[model samples]
Each structure stands twice: as C-alpha cells, then as structure tokens.
Target: MDLISSRLLFRPMEERDRRFMRRFLSDGELTRWLPVDYPCPMEQVHLHVDRRLEHWDKHGFGTFVLEEREGEGPVGYCGLEHVTETPFIDLRYGLVQSAQGRGLAFEAAMRVVTYGFHGLQLPRIFGAAMPDNKASVAVLTKVGMRPDKRFDCYGSNLFTASVDRVAFDLKAQPVTHTGIYGAHG
Candidate 1:
C-alpha cells in the first residue's frame, strides 16, 4: 500500500488498475479540467502506472491509486507531482463519475497532501484546475489551500491553489462520510 486513509487506501498502480484508468482517463468530463495537453490513451495509462511505480521507487512518493476500504474497489487517484520551475509539489486527483459528488476526491486528496507534507517533508504543495471546476475549488479550499492566482493554460483560465510549508495545517483530520472524506486545501 502506498498510503492509508480512514475509509480508503492509496496504493501503487498495478496492471489490474489499467481497466480503472481506462474508465477514468477516457471520461471527457473528468479530463476537461486536467492539465494534460492531449487525450489520455489506455496505452498511456498503462505507461503512466509503470512510471508511477518507478517514481515511487525513486522518490518515495508518487501518484497513488485510491480505493474504497469496503470492497477495495478503485475510486480514483491522487498525488503530488514535481513542477518543473517551482519548488512545489503539484497536487492532483481524478475520480470516476460514480465517485463524483461523494467527497471521495476530498478524502483522497487530504491523504496525499498529508503524506507530502508530514511524511515526505515537502515544503509546499499546489494545484491547478479549470476555473469552472467548482467541486475541485471547493475541495482545495476545504483543505486550507488558498487561491494563489489565475493563469492561462491551453487558452483557459486555470485557478491556482497552494499551501505554504510552514503554514500548512497538517493537523486537520479527514472527515469520512459515506465513503466520502472532506478537507480544505
């Protein structure tokens, strides 16, 4: 397991997770706000899983598969990615349609953020989402990430959220409700 949450588990991506990735990566609605420039193909999803595994081995932290604890079904993914020009971890997450509105994204993200700050000792974490992704915005805010600014990305306004290392509220515990978790920033 990569990490554990109250009602979910963050684990290394495996070959078995490819099917889940296919379902998630192909969802145009979910991908609309993602930072990737092109459509995510299944082949690429498999490659991404492999890369995530390698990343874990090398960096001790990487994107993880999020699964519910009851039946251990995959619900989404969340993790920190290194931004090229900044000394910050880019917090990212995605979930299936069934998982939307359930707050699983928030729970999964809190675990990722906690690991990035408390476990990995990262100094800062940030996120970017399309301005229209209110759900994401709400989750980011709930977790204590403040809106840093708005920037252009692929011709769209991307809202930036960040938490300073020294100011991160690492003590905030996740609230699990109906398999959904809540956190700010």
Candidate 2:
C-alpha cells in the first residue's frame, strides 16, 4: 500500500489541502484543460475535496494529496476511484503550475495506476482529458494507457484512455475498455 517514488508521496486527502486545491483548481490557464469551470470558487473546491474524502470511505480508494517529500506542503493531488456507477476505476490528477512540466504528474499518476492494479487488484484503470490537453494525454500515455475513444464528458469533448494488465501482458497493447467488471465490447 505504499505508493511512493523518489519525487512524490501519496497520502489521504486532508482538509488542509483546501488552500492548495483552491489555488490549483482556480488557475484560469490550468482549469482550461480541466472539465471544471474556471475561476472555481473556494466553496466549490471545498465541496470537491469533501466529496473525495467521502469517496475514500465508500470506494476504498480516492484522491490523495501529493507531497514533494516526507515533510513538505502538498504540490497536487491524484487518485483512482470508481465514481458512481462507472465500471472502471478513473484516474485523476492535478498539479500547481509551479509543479507542472517536471514529470511529477506522470510520476504520481503512474504510481496510482500501479497501486490500482497491484494493490487493489483492479482489472483496469482509465482517465479522460480534453483532446487539447496534451500534458494530460502525455501523462496517461507515458503510464501505458492508450486512447480508447473520443466522447463527451461534463459538456466537453474528451479523449478516454485506458490499459488492462492482462491485455498489456499478453498483447502488449494499451488500448482496452476491459475492466474489473468486464470489457466494453
């Protein structure tokens, strides 16, 4: 259950993360790539974080605040959770602008993807990002997920990417909707 790398550490999201989340989620430039509306109010940020905490209880896994090291402020958050009825565990992450472009997002996400498969014994993990959000696409791709489809999500068109461990092991292919429940065929 240890999801740690040289540059990142993952811990359950905490109330103190509100300020960092507010700053990151509210950044106009960064939010443009995200499905969230820009200028996200602090209230909405609070609500989102609270929901993530609840998700941890119900789903056994949810968003986690990413730390730079053992004793540093949170730089971002990432997690794997099966939202609502979604058959696949969804991977999500965001980093403050200062933290971007340093490969931290990919590192954090890959760690969670590994935890989802090896720790939780999940069959698959998926993530969605705006088609133009190259950074996010790169992160997913770098972690061995391939684009599975283009679809509408939260009023925006996004490219969905996923990877199945068995498929990757057998065919070495990253494109698949097969999840813990079943495949998307």
Candidate 3:
C-alpha cells in the first residue's frame, strides 16, 4: 500500500525498515509513553516486520511505515491493529523523537484513518494513548475522533478514542466514506 500526502508517504513496511524500527523502538524518549517493548533487538525487529507483512498479506491491512515525501527518511509507523477479543481497529502510531511536533503525526494519522474507513471499508476506528500523551490525543482529536473510554492497558492509564461509522460518514464532507483499496487507488 502507498498513501501520499503533501509532506508524508505511508508505504508498506519493507525489510529495510527493520533497522529504523529497531532504533525507533529502542529510543527511551520515544517509547516512554508507548508500551515497554524496549531495547528491541535487530533479530526481533526482523521477525516483527516479517510477521506484520504476513498479516498484511493475509488480512489486506496492517501497520505501515510512515516516511517523508521524497525520501526524507522514515519518521514513524502507524496502522490499524486488531484489538484482541473485540471487533475494533486499534490505531497505533510511534515516531522518532526528532520528528515530533511538526504535525506529521496528525497528517499521517488523518490519511491512515481515511484508509481505514475508505480503503479497508472499516465501520469504525479507535485509538488509545496514555493520559500523559497529550500529543497523540491531539492528533486523534484533530482527525475527528472522540474520547470514548478510559482504562488501564499494559499496566498504565489509557484513553480510548473512536470514530464510529455514522460519525465518520458525517464528519468529512468532501471525503466520501465509500471503500477504496489503497493498493489499487
């Protein structure tokens, strides 16, 4: 899949992205609010990438690597993951510390949400962020998602946000809700 924006590119996670993922996952500042999967070894990143790719092939959607337009480099990764035991799409995103606060996350997330609704034909999408993660909460809110619930996840406080099917359809005027596969579009 390839999603192009004015300043970012959302592309399928490739093998070469493992190294960047390793670094991104290991950074203390970047992973502070995220789940502690710290010190991600290269081998594990390789395996993780492989597994994500496999899931994408089987399910037609998985987390994708977010890079800059024109090869500026990978800044982050974002995508919809199945919420265990629930019929929901959990939106996840993580970015390099250096890339924070430039509106990239919001732009990338908006595009990804568009894909989830239109491309994947999903009825709803949700995201969770640690209460302290003001930045992420802002991104979700900017995309028209609303706080639905608050609960503990991964042993920490979490905030859940969502855009229901009807609400999603009503939120974006120019953007249609009809499904459109990214790979083909």
Using lDDT as the measure, what is the rank order of every candidate, best first? 3, 2, 1
Model 2 over residues 1-185: C-alpha lDDT tens digits?
33566567788886777788888777787677876566688788888778887888887788988888755788888998775654667889988777899888977876677667766888888888887888898888877788776323444468787888764345323424322222331
Q: What C-alpha root-mean-square deviation, in Å, does candidate 3 show against the real structure?
A: 3.6
Off by over 4 Å in 2: 150-156, 167-185
How badly does each model clash, as a count of residue pairs? 9, 0, 0
Per-prediction TM-score to the true structure, in the order listed: 0.80, 0.82, 0.83
User: Candidate 1: TM-score?
Assistant: 0.80
Candidate 1 lDDT over residue span 92-162, tens digit each: 79887777888788878777777777677787788887778899988888777887753232234677878
Candidate 2 TM-score over all chains jointly:
0.82
**2 or 3: which has the higher TM-score?**
3
| Model 3 bad stretches (over 4 Å) | 39-43, 150-156, 174-185
* C-alpha-based local distance difference test score of model 1: 0.72
For residue 22, model 2's alpha carbon misses the true position, in angstroms, by: 1.9
RMSD of 2: 6.6
Q: What is residue 38's positional error in candidate 2, in angstroms?
A: 3.5
